[model samples]
Target: MADIERHDYDVIVIGAGGAGLRAAIEARSRGLRTAVVCKSLFGKAHTVMAEGGIAASMGNVNSRDNWQVHYRDTMRGGKFLNNWRMAELHAKEAPQRVWELETYGALFDRTPEGKISQRNFGGHEYPRLAHVGDRTGLELIRTLQQKIVSLQQEDHAEHGDYEARLRVYPECTVTELLLDEGRIAGAFAYWRENGRFLRLEAPTVVLATGGIGKSFKVTSNSWEYTGDGHALALRAGANLIDMEFVQFHPTGMVYPPSVKGILVTESVRGDGGVLRDAEGRRFMFDYVPEVFKGSYADSEQEADGWYSDPDNNRRPPELLPRDEVARAINSEVKEGRGSPHGGVYLDVASRLPAEEIARRLPSMHHQFKELADVDITAESMEVGPTCHYVMGGVEVDPDTAASGVAGLFAAGEAAGGMHGSNRLGGNSLGDLLVFGKRAGAGAAEYVAGLGARPEVSQADVEAAEQRALRPFEESGSAAAQHPYALHGELQQVMNELVGIIRRGEEMSSALDELAELKDRAGHMAVFEGNRQFNPAWHLTLDVANMLLVSECVARAALRRTESRGGHTRDDHPGMDATWRRRQLVCEHRDGAVTVTERTHPPMRRDLLELFDITELRKYFTADELGEVTAEL
Candidate 1:
């Protein structure tokens, strides 16, 4: 008999990052019994590793910035391929979310006048991102965690309802969703500490499980980012959008194999740091033209002057949008003007006081000093692109956060449509809160009216259970593979064939490599010993998600013939107008992946008919054809 422990909750939330936690809080507020499950400790999700601030057009410092400007900047930053509704919602709700964070006891950095300080990020028309120095994510996560604890305590004392709602299950990993009939019913998972299976029965399931950065070799992402939510949604028949676009943050520490490439935080650039090649030449000015044309400055004097008067021009070098900076570094590295360490030098040491640098970037100091034995405050840090965030994920309506699948919902990096091609450095934190709330409400509302749990086949549960337990049964043989070895091979293959730049041949080869790795994974064996917190065992499952997500990426990348956003193909290097009309959505059906086209929403009639801002906002929509067709 199966060792089954069942739980019943009104709603089940997977992943305990900022998004999942926020969702749980909102669910409880709506009177639902909520349970938050995660693979790591409560505060240790990828959100804690986010170095930069949160994007919110608060206009605290720059009164010139508003949601309209924020919306335009976001659309342009995403290379005009973003879902307009999602972008609009994000721009409109982000400021209020940031304010909400403040109300929850988040202590943000204050300006001299004592208002929340805003900084410039890549692609913003005005200084807009509200930050707590470079550790904004750390602050954000800690504050949210504390608030949730407070709420749980209050709810317990006020109503004696502690046992019913707002549960946090750390170190537990969800293995499969239990779908009944055609809607979400619940999920099955196992605790990492002792390997006990736990089944949760809920009317609604929200996946805020973060990104798929672990699919690549040299990533700045944490080990927990295995595309769990994306993979789960796919198996559950949810649609995935823009899987071709993965963002590589430009300034990561590239040496020291143990830490590999740690994110160096974009705030370093926003705080007046500069990027220079080995020859000490600044090259961002050349590439900043088309994108930053009017907003950017050409000379050092002008760049420096703009820092003091950000309203007149952009602030700080290295603070440009992630895509531009990444491309510039790629170009420099390609031309052999890289630093001694094969990356460009990020020289924040020259601009800021030592005390200020240490205070603002405490994590950077700790990471470099502990891992690389380098004191960043005294020296220029060698940096380059590292896999950081996915701009593509399980596609959903931005407003509802509902997947094409009836009972599935997603938020955070797991659900795409907000950041079209490239994500700005500080925008993710605010995204988690805004969309988390929406997804929570969506899931709760769906559950409040849920009918009987759908029919779940015993065969389905058995298949998933068998797959989950396969690693424990495997034995060592000559042909037996090790998870780490297979993992390394997989990462190397993905990095080489589908990374930075792509070609049709390269993607095809990647698909073949993926096939081989997937086959080999079946023979893989976990290391002997206790299953308690066994990373190797966890990795075996992660590899499955990695392969599934990567295959989708390769398939989608091959289908898109034009270069746009973060997906650049040397063979097809320019954006195709026809390609801009629709988005490619990928779904897994009957155990095979299939692709379909989803038409972009028509330009809003109200916006199109408006006289003054029509043209400016029209760019936010896909180009117009006189007639409309349901088939994209």
Candidate 2:
């Protein structure tokens, strides 16, 4: 057996993003020794890429905004497919999370009265997002990192070592989760800088490793989002829910092939930007579905008036949920009204003064000027749909963030059922803070109650090491394939067939292609080189995870035959009331992925009362509606 480094912790957190840091802080505060591990450097997790603010109904900007209203908007934005309990908790707890960040030394932009400033974003009914300019995510990470440092300082004073109670392992990637009798034992990982193996034996593991956006060719996700946590959970005998519903954010850069999929923050539209076609027509107005008809303005005059007097006028259709906007852009481009780069025009310069645009959206202005060489404050940006987030992920308990697998918990984008079909912009950061704390508390409680700590067996560690070395062993073989080529093919297959708009036949074909890719991935090899700092070797491991996750997505998508939220099936263009009650669950067994359908638990009667019967009728079946009414 190869020599491997070993460490023990009460809780091991995989990923150093907002969720991971929050979870670690909660655990350490609860007096548990905790470890945070990530594939990127400390404070460089993809959470920094979140341009929009954190969603919380603090009502700093609108007195009418509260948890109930926020909850209602969240359910509506998800098309009534959200987990009602999770949505309720998120709405109720997000405000406290934002306030807590201030206690951790976060400096949010303030209104005239010295309260946290709130801003508008898509799918939100009010100016509900508490932000620090357009770089809210960066501020969030900075604040969390500062909190961690403070915790370390406290530990150093007490124990004469900064890492006495909490530690951070950056540039470390967990390749496999070791289990003991179906429970989480530890994680097997390698240092990205040296390729040496290490093990962290813990009874509880919290997976906060973001989403699977990198599985597609055109995506706004960073390299670390290769669905590591999702794949790990599945392989550890956990189920993933709603794997079919993937969110395609409406606006990504479409010009300059190199930066085609870079994100264009929704803050642009939130701050009075509009989407136009080549003919200079605001095309989003034409694409509002019947369900969303009265909520959006029908005329240009009404929409423009909303910026100044939102209380009097309905918002523009451009401020609709992300799914609606992305589909609208797709329709415009397919109808030949697209910009020169096969996208629609997003115009913010014409609505806001150049100075205001620079102040409100500094990151966006700099991102565009530096990458695409387009001055966002002077002209419209060529923007279109790009894969942004996956609504599906590891299925877990709403209250605890615990999977069916004992000792294994998930939160943030890695967990499913929170955003059932679609996620509202700004909701993600709040989700991280809210659930990260819950997961940490849950893991601490679980550890406190355990009879015996789970142990990692030497055999399992050896198997993990061999699994990590497969690419090296296959390097000199004649049948070996390049990992990059396989990765490219997998991305193309997913981007083309199972993307924003889906069809039965296309998804079926995608599953077939994914199966082929999976077989090829087994033979993928990197050029003979030392694993130290080798990106090709790292990609060789990531490709397998992406292929497995893509298979789950394709299989679940093929089984779901209705158009709703992120899983839009052109063959079945309307959302099904019956289907709204069902969720597609993905599981792995017998070396293949299988998808099964299950009904969602009825929404709590109290939560159901938040919406009117008229709104409920659009999404719920007559039988379900009768049950709800009778329960009420």
Candidate 1 lDDT by residue in tens digits, 1-632: 47767788888899989888888888888988889998999888889887778888888888878888887777777876788788888889999999999999999999889989998777776778788877888888898888878878877898787545788899999988888766887888989998777878887889999999988998989888988999999998888999999998888887765766789888778777889999888778877735455567778888888778745665544667787788789889989999877789888888889888888878887888888998878888889988888999888878878888777889999999898888876778888999999999998888877667565556676777788878877855566678898888889988999988889999999999988888888877776865677778888888888888999989989999987778888899876666766788889988777777877776555433322343333333333634222222
lDDT of 1 at 129: 79
Q: Give the best candidate by lDDT.
A: 2
Pairs of residues clashing in candidate 2:
none
Residue range 318-362, candidate 2, lDDT tens digits? 999999999999999998999998999999999989999999999
Give the CA lDDT, 0 to 100, for residue 523 in model 1.
74
- Pairs that collide in candidate 1 are 122-320, 122-321, 180-454, 180-455, 181-454, 181-455
Measured by TM-score, the strongest candidate is 2
- TM match of model 1 to true structure: 0.94
- Alpha-carbon runs more than 4 Å astray in model 2: 627-632
What is the TM-score of candidate 2?
Answer: 0.99
- Each candidate's number of clashing pairs is 6, 0
